[model samples]
Target: MSSSEPRPESGPTVPSVLTWGTWAAVVLVAAQLVLGILMLSGSWSLIEAHAGLGYAGTLAAVLAAVSAVVWKRRGGSAGVMAHAVAMPVLMIIQIGLGSAGVKWVHVVLGVLILIGLIGLPMSLRSARRQSL
Candidate 1:
């Protein structure tokens, strides 16, 4: 390595588990939204798949929350940690709403959850860049 050449910086890398889990949750939530729209449009046959994905999305949210906690323990942002923790809680309520047959609230909450899930990764990346 020459002095004139740039050296690779070494520091904390963004948490892969958090990033991957958040994206997975985002995908699951988006798919659920689509399945939901279809069901609302009279395609009741997709209900089974939609319900299955909702459970998976909840699992993913919980995992992401765990990863966020780990990240915070390792000097991550408190706001990010809070956001991560909230995701799963929201998901649980969303699930309950769905189960209770409150279709409109469930749909609205699902959209909000999807937006949150999508924001998580972006926030992680921004924090990484700021730390660099």
Candidate 2:
């Protein structure tokens, strides 16, 4: 390569979801845990707990959507594409449970969302590596 020759076009520096989205995912997990605790302690009503958990789940879904958008924007990897699809699916399940006010569904979705929060960072790291 010569100094006069131009380099290939580098992709966007930031992921589509960015730091805020990741933080939102994190917050969602923590908030869901707290909401669950509140429900158990009777400090909060079931409806309130459901609402809080739903909010967190929605945040995670948004993060996934943003990740997918970012991937599309940068022409990134398949992993991001997966995140885009999976996140919304999980969010829908999460919200349905919240709205239906089902006990087991709420618990299961809460667990799944927490797993998603933990898995997302690892997934992003893998995506970054693959993109590189």
Candidate 3:
């Protein structure tokens, strides 16, 4: 290799803009949780707001999962992709319970979804670093 010759390009220096999907999922889910808690505590209100945001998070999760799958096919990690898919599935169950007013299970699933949302992004970041 001579100084005048072009060198091969290095790997990604910046993360993908697709990360917004992960962040959107996390933020929407967190907001939904807060809304649910407020409704339960009888202080804050808006069941409709919670439901709407819950659905938004649900869609975001699916989108994020798709992004992860694409990323994985491109030689990224599966853990993050798995988590992205898992969260929405769990959230849907939570929503169903809430819709049917199956109190206890709905609350339980909400807790799990919150945990998943938090963990998914963290796992993704770690996996991305390892891939890099």
lDDT to native, each model: 0.87, 0.64, 0.75
Tell me the tens digit of each residue's lDDT in model 2 across 1-132. Answer: 664433355333336454457657667667767777777687666656657656765766676676667666666555556665676677777677767768777777777777776676676677655444
Question: Considering summed lDDT, which 10 consecutive residues are worst modelled in model 3?
Answer: 6-15
- Residue-level lDDT for 132 in candidate 3: 47
* Residue 60 accuracy (lDDT) in model 3: 83
TM-score of each: 0.89, 0.71, 0.82
**Runs off by more than 4 Å, candidate 2:** 1-16, 46-50
Please write out the lDDT profile of model 3 over residues 1-132, one tens digit for every residue.
775433344222213544777788789988888888888889545889988998998888877877777776765666667787788788788889989999788888888888878887678667655544
Q: Taking the tens digit of each residue's C-alpha lDDT, what string does model 1 give over 1-132?
A: 775433356224558888888888999999999999999999999989999999998898899899888878867777888999999999999989999999999999999999988888889988777556
Q: How many pairs of residues in model 2 come into backbone collision?
A: 1
Best-matching candidate per TM-score: 1
Decoy 2 TM-score against native: 0.71
Flag clash pairs in model 2: 16-70
Worst 10 residues of 1 by lDDT: 3-12
Report the C-alpha displacement of residue 33, candidate 3, in angstroms.
Answer: 1.4
Clashes found in each candidate (C-alpha, N, C closer than 3 A): 0, 1, 0
